[model samples]
Target: MTDQSAAPDATPRPLDHLAAMGAPDALALVDRAGALSFTGLDRAVGALARALDGRGLAKGARVASWLAKTRLASLLPLACARAELVHVPINPLLKRGQVAHILQDSGASLLIAGAGRSGTLEAGDRPADCALLIEDEAGAASLAAQDGLPASAADPDALAAILYTSGSTGRPKGVMLSHANLWLGAVSVAHYLRLTADDRTLAVLPFSFDYGQNQLLSSWAAGACVYPLDYLTARDVIRAVDKHEITTLAGVPPLWVQLAEADWPEATAGRLRRITNSGGRLPVPLVHRLRQLFPAADLYSMYGLTEAFRSTYLDPALIDTHPDSIGGAIPFAEVMLVRPDGGLAATGEPGELVHAGPLVAQGYWQDAERTALRFRPAPVFSKYGGMAVWSGDTAVMDADGLLRFVGRDDEMIKTSGNRVSPTEVEEAAVATGAAAEAVAIGVPDDRLGEAILLVVRGDPAGEGALRDGLKRDLPNFMQPREIRWRADLPRNANGKVDRAGLKAELTS
Candidate 1:
């Protein structure tokens, strides 16, 4: 066990992260609009902060942004923190129901969104008190505003952002991140990845993702410029990389597969200095193909949960030799494999991957019941000596102290580099009135990593209604690849849906 809290919490506030790096004239950000220098980005952040502060929001009030990867969306995270508010970034891909849930659960006082998305919300979709602001130049604060606030001197452990992610059997929970968590995580990833000012990162993932948000924060920490892209196709990514001369790229497994098979000019493929993977494990064959295609770039395979931000990451040097490992503990993180007896697992023994340290998130927002179930005091053997995130993920540490991916303790379905709750899908399926009983199952798919197979105990004719209803209620990723209709469904001893039995039958 490493000394998790050996150093006191001296981490800088997230807003100050901007002021410390990047010279005034150096390039800082690139978007569809144009490039902005470090000085220009700093001023924009300050102006946005001043505008948000001018609003009559109380300190620590929840300020949510549900727009695309626009300039306002990009600047809101740090801007909210500087104004002593918590930012809740809703995934733009989510529909109205999911958006409404977040607004109600987070008690968001204000929502800034584009008309395209804001129009999707009807009647009760928005909370009674949640005010709305347009996302354009006149709607919210514009980039050309003035009176930017200086770097903040706020508490390092105060809430900075609330990132909502799905759990195994419940509605999406908002993972509360503090300034220290975000700062230390950025510094750790930048140091391990050896980021530098000259590096250019093409951020293709959503800012709502923990790892995705880190791309911006970590790049800023290293004084590197960031190019944020919201792409609809793989070719868009290729074009962006070529246009921006990007050095860093981060994606999940499903995307890696697409890129590996993508036709890239030799020069374009070699431009990447580093590629990082999260969201899911990469197949060995996929890893080999990536190595063959981008031999010059370092590949990092990382594993993390929202509760802790991140845990283990494979060293680029060991990728070929030990391709399956999730590596060991990251900086400021002490990852331990604890057996059922609350004792540390011996080498080669399966145990839950428990992460202890400052990088741990504060916990889910306003859900004390679930919070206690996930966040608890560290084991008596812990050196961190505080609450640790019991990941509920099983893994085995090799004698070399390297950890390998095992399985999740729950039936959470991971598809397209995002975690999906089977319960949410089942609930939506039944809500369509297409099924008397519904069971959402995740089956292995070479393309999607895992394809959703929704089984329903309803009329075969109801399949159309089921698919259409799910389309409205759930995101595309949550839609079932196949809907299996049955006259009757299996049941457990307690007479509830036997999910284990269904999964067993399908896999068997």
Candidate 2:
């Protein structure tokens, strides 16, 4: 890991750095608003910042965006940063109640949304104290003629954005990120991904997610172009790759499973240089299939949490040898496996993953109880003394220094007086080639205390065949007691399978 304590000078700020990358007319983003150049992006952000300031929002006040992935939506964060305001991006897929919760919870001073989306909000949805600005009305030409926002004493340590969690378990809590947290994360990812000016990345993930938001930052940091896409199917992704000659793409495991099954044209397949995975582990069988499909493209298996933008990434070169490992720490991050006794775990022993470094976020926005539980002091032996994210994820470090994921501490299933990782069971089910996706949950059972419930989405005809395969592959206690087939599993806004939701539904 690079020196996290070292601070980078921020006189021009990150937004200006993108525009000053030599070619002002070079493309920065492509969307319905047309091809926006670096200079155009800089000016557009400035115009919006001025508009927000003119509308009477105090410096550091929260400005939330609840629109789709439009050009204006892409510019909101930069605009908020320039105005020294805290940006809160709400997932467009959220319902009325969820949107209301965020608006009231953040106590935002203003909200910028599309005309169509703005009409969807009821009186109860947004606070009476907060103002609303229609994005379609905030055009570049009109806003540019107005006065620009006055400079402020904004520093790197100031809070930049508040990203809300998926809230599968409870009400969504905002994850606070500082300007330094975002800036350093962008620099680290761009350096390690080897992003160059020639690279054209497709941004399909929601910007509300830290992983998705980094797509824009990392691409712009490298002077590369990003194409914003709200794709509906695997075909759309393939078409975008061919249309924009996209070199880099990032996706969750569920999306990858769908894309892997799509029929890729030779030209579309050749344009892709790299694909990164997170949100969940990529099954070994799917990894082999991706290699066969995209022989020229590099595959990066990564592991991360919202608290820390990213933690580890397995290098493309080691994909075959270490498919199960989450790799070592990424740039600017130090990942340690701490045992239950609050000490470092020995080699091959599973321990909680603790992330310590600059990338650790500022913690939850207003939930101190939750924040204190996840974000705590660094380990006793650490070189740093500040707070570290105590990620509840369990992992084991091998002799080669690569970290392999076990499962979440709370998600571990107890069966027959033994602890079982749902990931292990799910991996085995997917390897049988009888299911496209699998999730194993433990429900109440008097005999076993908790029994395995294997849920899958695949051809119904193959269920018996998969059961036979599982019988041979798994021991008695680890075997799932029942198998249920569904047309499709429910996915949250982040594209991850809604495990908590599924469990609640089963119990209810």
RMSD of each: 2.8, 10.6
Residue 389 C-alpha lDDT in model 1: 94
How close to the true structure is residue 3 of candidate 1, measured as C-alpha lDDT?
A: 21
Candidate 1 per-residue lDDT, tens place, 242-268, comes to: 988999999999999899889988899
Q: What is the C-alpha lDDT profile of model 2 across 299-396, one tens digit per residue? A: 98888888987899998999999888889888888899998899999999999999998889998988898889999998996665589999888999
Error of 2 at 106 (Å): 0.7
Give the true-structure RMSD of model 1.
Answer: 2.8
Error of 1 at 189 (Å): 0.6
The candidate that wins on TM-score is: 1
List the pairs of residues colliding in candidate 2: none
| Cα lDDT, all candidates | 0.87, 0.80
Candidates in order, TM-scores: namely 0.97, 0.79
